[model samples]
Target chain A: MTGKAHCYKRDHINTDEIIPARYLNMDREADLAQHAMEDIDPEFVKKINQGDFIIAGEDFGCGSSREHAVWALRGAGVRAVIADTFARIFYRNCVNNGFLAIECPGISQQVDSGDELEIDIEKGIIKNRTKGDQYTFQPITGFAREVIGAGGLLNYIAGKVV
Target chain B: MGATITEKILAAHCGRTQVNPGELINAEIDVIMCHDVTTTPAIDMLTDRGLSRVAHPERVVVIPDHFVPNKDIKSAEMVAKIRRWAKEQGIDKFYELGRHGVCHALLPEQGYVRPGITIVCGDSHTCTHGALGAFSTGIGSTDLAATLATGKLWFKVPETILFRLNGKLGKGVYAKDVILEIIRQIGVDGALYKAMEFTGELIDELSVEARMTICNMAIEAGGKSGIINPDQKTINYVEAHTAEPFKIFKSDSDAEYCRIVEINVTDLEPLVAFPHLPSNGKPVWQVGEIPVDQAYIGSCTNGRIEDLRVAAEILKNRQVAKNTRMIVVPATTNIWKQANQEGLLDIFMAAGAAVSTPTCGACLGGHMGILAAGERCISSTNRNFIGRMGSPQSEVYLASPATVAASAVAGKIADPRNYM
Candidate 1:
């Protein structure tokens, strides 16, 4: 998959900023889409289209196990998120919600905001198309990959139980 | 090979004779909890997947504490739906509003959590149960649905970090200060995906409540869970509430740890985490006199009985600052009842503080004591992230209950030592 990077060059981006608490009462993903990342970047929704990526520094998606953070990002047409590292619960939430979350150390330093990037999920390679450089990352493997391949844990469990 | 406490617990629950770090296994869960905020979404996902029955309905506990007393009609409807679902599912463990407290505190108080078991919840602070030596961690709504459907979930055995705490705590220094200092030393993500096993002389000397306070905020430092080996204090506390049998596991003497760090709390003082991050910790003496508009003393982190007593002691016969508003929330109804019976609630009332029911109110900026733009608050809650308590322009300083109470009385970020 390929997308243009929307870089937020900061560390420890928490879920509260990804989707504020005031908007958490909603039940629909579409209702949460507009407010996604608005706390950190007010025009975040207007700056992106389908199949975009969020490139961030270390400790991305920290604080709170609110899955609404992932839902909001997915609904905003973000295909994947690339960060130096992710908070544990957020990484699991990303995989469980059928959204791609990649961790590439020193990735933020290599690519600029709006840089074109290509990712090969199966091969675990990230290509900065704009910089003409490639980096290898640890791919989601084993049961985690299987769960994500089935479009989240719900479908994986449905298949297993049935 | 020797195993850590977490490995021992996971192995026991998975029915495996042995396991190690990085080994993926599906372990049976002893309890699963969902609160008001996440229950609606979890129920929706479960029903959408065409699942009608929970694998072990009796093991599932639902508590409506997040938006209890129903903030509005929408919240009321959400609570109603969960109540209906619990009834339809015959989930007798469900605790409705006013019947229970916050999910994290209520679980342990009601004997739902035991040592050497695995617990999963939809809330992030599920690590609080690890204080009892359980392998507890938080999961998402989808994972909650899967566990509800199957009674088991996948887990990657995590490497362990041993925090060896030693020395006697100084006057006004608290478990909250120790934990905040740990977070300050090791940035927010220092222990990502790792189990934090707290051991040492100081931890053994602390009450179970204080241990719970320490473990509850392990998630703030990016730990998957925080644990302390169950000692006589834990046994005595659990025995009073539960007759059910439970195992007590310990790390092997030679067990390998990813890293071992020692923190000596002999001369530690009260600490306050600055705005926007828990890692931005500063000793109370170092932080200058900053004014505060509000002071809140409650959350899964520091809303236990001991926390209340500390606050009560500081506020006794002293009025809160006229310019500052203070709200105190017990972590559980049991704690509230005990505080009221002990006249602690009376002390707070006389001190011009508002005592509210047990909820995660205002901690997540949901309700009760939200701040206005450019306002500042001194809170005992865990996180002090930007906009966490209200407007992004507002600031939150996190400290122990004593520090919060003292700050309330002084109308600013005052040192708890002064009040002591």
Candidate 2:
């Protein structure tokens, strides 16, 4: 996907910050996305464009294993999340919800906000389409790759059954 | 080629002779658990799948713990729905307010959880049962809904990480501290999707409550589960409360481990996870003058009778800091009664601490003790994630019960050593 990378230059962006527990009442995925990151940075949703990638520092998505966090990101049109590392629950939620959670440890140092970038999960490379800098990362595991490729766990299971 | 307790349990659940890391397997779930807060969603999904009958109705447990007395009309409606759903679904083990306790405490105490079985719960603290040598982990609502419809779960057998702690723990340093130090070493995500097996003399020395505390925070380290091999402690605990027999599992001497992290507990000091992250930690001595507006000691992490006893011992003859509000909530009604009989409640009351009933009152800021804007709290609960204890403007510092009690007395974030 091609888009301006709306990077969040912070560490330990917990689930509560991504989607607060107060919004748990909203059952729909799309409604939850409108308030995503409202707890940390109120302007997050307004500044975000479609198909932006989130690059974070260590321990991203640490906290409660609420699936709404993934829904919020997906609703906000987040295509991929490349972080140094992810909390296990958040990683699983991302995989189950079809959002790409890439492990590009130390990728936070490479780009700035509004820096146009392109991430190719199939090619196992991220090109800094703006700075002319490119980096390689190990591909997601075979099972995780398949799940992401299939759009989600439920989708993957459905596809497998079909 | 013998297997460790974890491997044996996984194999038994997987219905296989041998199980390897990274292999996907569907396993029989011995117990399916849900609380009031998360049960509604799982139930909706289960009903959506046209599931008229549960695979094993008696094996499922529903507990209304988050808002025990139904904090508000909304909380009341949520719990009432769960109780009604459980009855309709033919689940026999439904514990309502006054009868219910924390899911982790009620599970093993009721003898529903035994070794050599796989358990799945909608809550992340489900791994707390792994202290008894069961293969258990938390699942998302979608996966939980699937498990509810069909009493099974799919898992990718993870490589095992070994943690070996030897020597004796110093005074005022307990299992809570040990877990905090472990989180400090293996950042929050270091052990993502890996199994952590605790072994060594220290494991033998720790009590069941202490062991549960260690395994409970395995989620904080980003591990699938934390487990210890069942031994005499496990046997005794099961035998004392349960009449049913159990088949325990132990680790083999030659079982392979992905990585081994060793620690010498004798020299270790109490640790704290500062505001905003469970893995953001430093030694207790290094943290100075971080004031706390509230001090809470409860939750599945440190809400047991033993933990309450330790806090009561420290608060017996002292008064709390005038500015700090200390709240103590027992894990269960039985624990509350036991503390009452032992005069622990009086000790806390005399020290100007509010003793709440058995509920997960303020752990998630769902009800009582919710922090106002810009307030700070030092608590013994798991996860200091933002807005965990209430307002987004507030900050939470995670620590041991002793440290929390001490901080309450000092008005600032003080380690247990200063009081001891």
Candidate 3:
């Protein structure tokens, strides 16, 4: 999978902002997808295309361990989220739901918006296709990587256990 | 080499002799949990992945606490999905509306948590269970799904920062105040992604309920989890609730802590976290005569029996402010029953306070007592983020139950000690 890493350098991107509690009533992916990031930036839904990424500062997804945050990101066409750090809950939610959330220390500073990039998660390297910059990250465990590789924990578990 | 309590527990559970912070380690999880607000999506994702049965049914817990009694059709449908999923999965433990309180409170009370065990849930407040000496923390839906399927989790163990409290809390001061004070000193990002191990004389003086209150808010400080070593109070609490003996573990005197924060509680007065931030705390008096449109005393943070007692005692022989509305909700049915049996409910009712059924109502601005535009309310719940309690224009002031109850009577924010 390849995409231009569309980076937004913001921190404390809580679950509430990812998918506001108001739209939690809607469960369908399409309906919920339209409201993604409506709380944080009203126009975020209109700003990006599929396969874009988000790079954030510290404590991303800091409040409310709601999985909707991951769902909203996945639904919004975000393929991966590279951040300096993530709230434990948010990080796990991403992998469980099949979205790629990578923790690369100082990743927020390595790139800016419009900086074309290729994230080879399996190789544990983020190739800045635009600047020809390559950064190595602490790869998730084989199991976690496999889970995300298979499109999330549920999908991974289905293949392995079911 | 000596290990912090967090490191030791992770090592013991994961079967490693020693583990270092920031190293990827996949540890076995004893319990995996999710609740209403998050569980429906989790179940959907789990099913979409084609899982038929949980790897360990008994180890997985699903509670529908957030929107119980169904405020709207959407919430009802979400809960309906969970109910059907629970039944089909043969899930033995499912708490319905009245049966559910907060997931954090219900887990320990039902003996699902024990010390030295590693627990993960889909709610940040899952750290509350760590008060039992377990390594409990919150995980996201993606992680919860993996845990449900494999019954294991990968983690880079976090380093710990120790917080030692000394001296006794002064009148009307409480664990909520202590936590707020700590957050004030450390700022919101103070312990980002770190564990907080609380030790010291003041902890010994606190009841287990009070300690749970302290640990419950540890997440607000940006810590992975906050825990106190199990002592007599902790043991007694476990004993009173469970027939099964739980293993107790304590931090070695020689354990290494990254940094230790020492706090003297003797001089503390009542504290309040103003709207939009948990750490925006100041002495109750420092807030000076702040008026309130409402007062609320409930939530996972400070909704226990003792919390109720404190509020009820202060409300007796008084009435809520003529212009202000006050709502008192028991955290659980058991706490509600105990208050009824002890006549605490009478005090609340006689004081012109509206007593509601146990729900997470208005804590996240999901239901009853939601503030109208430009309104302000003093609450015993955690979090005061903008629009957290209702409209973005509305404000929430976080305080202990005593302060909420006392303020309910005075029709403005007032210190509980003044009335006590």
User: In terms of DockQ, which candidate is stronger, 1 or 2?
Assistant: 1
Global fold similarity of model 2 (TM-score)? 0.93
RMSD to the native, candidate 1?
A: 1.1
In model 1, chain B matches the true chain B with a TM-score of 0.99
The superposed Cα distance between candidate 3 and the true structure at residue A71, in angstroms, equals 1.4
TM-score of each: 0.98, 0.93, 0.90
**Residue range B126-148, candidate 2, lDDT tens digits:** 88988988888988776766676
Candidate 1, B296-371: lDDT as tens digits: 9999999999999999999999999999999999989999999999999999999999999998889998889988
- Report the CA-based lDDT of candidate 1 relative to the real structure: 0.90
Question: How accurate locally, in lDDT, is each candidate?
Answer: 0.90, 0.83, 0.82
DockQ-based class of model 2:
acceptable
TM-score winner: 1
TM-score of chain A of each: 0.97, 0.94, 0.90
User: What ranking emerges by lDDT with the best candidate at the front?
Assistant: 1, 2, 3
B111-221 per-residue lDDT for model 3 (tens digits)? 787777889987888888778788988777667766777788777788889999999998899999999999889866678778888889998888877888988888887
What DockQ does every candidate get? 0.78, 0.42, 0.51
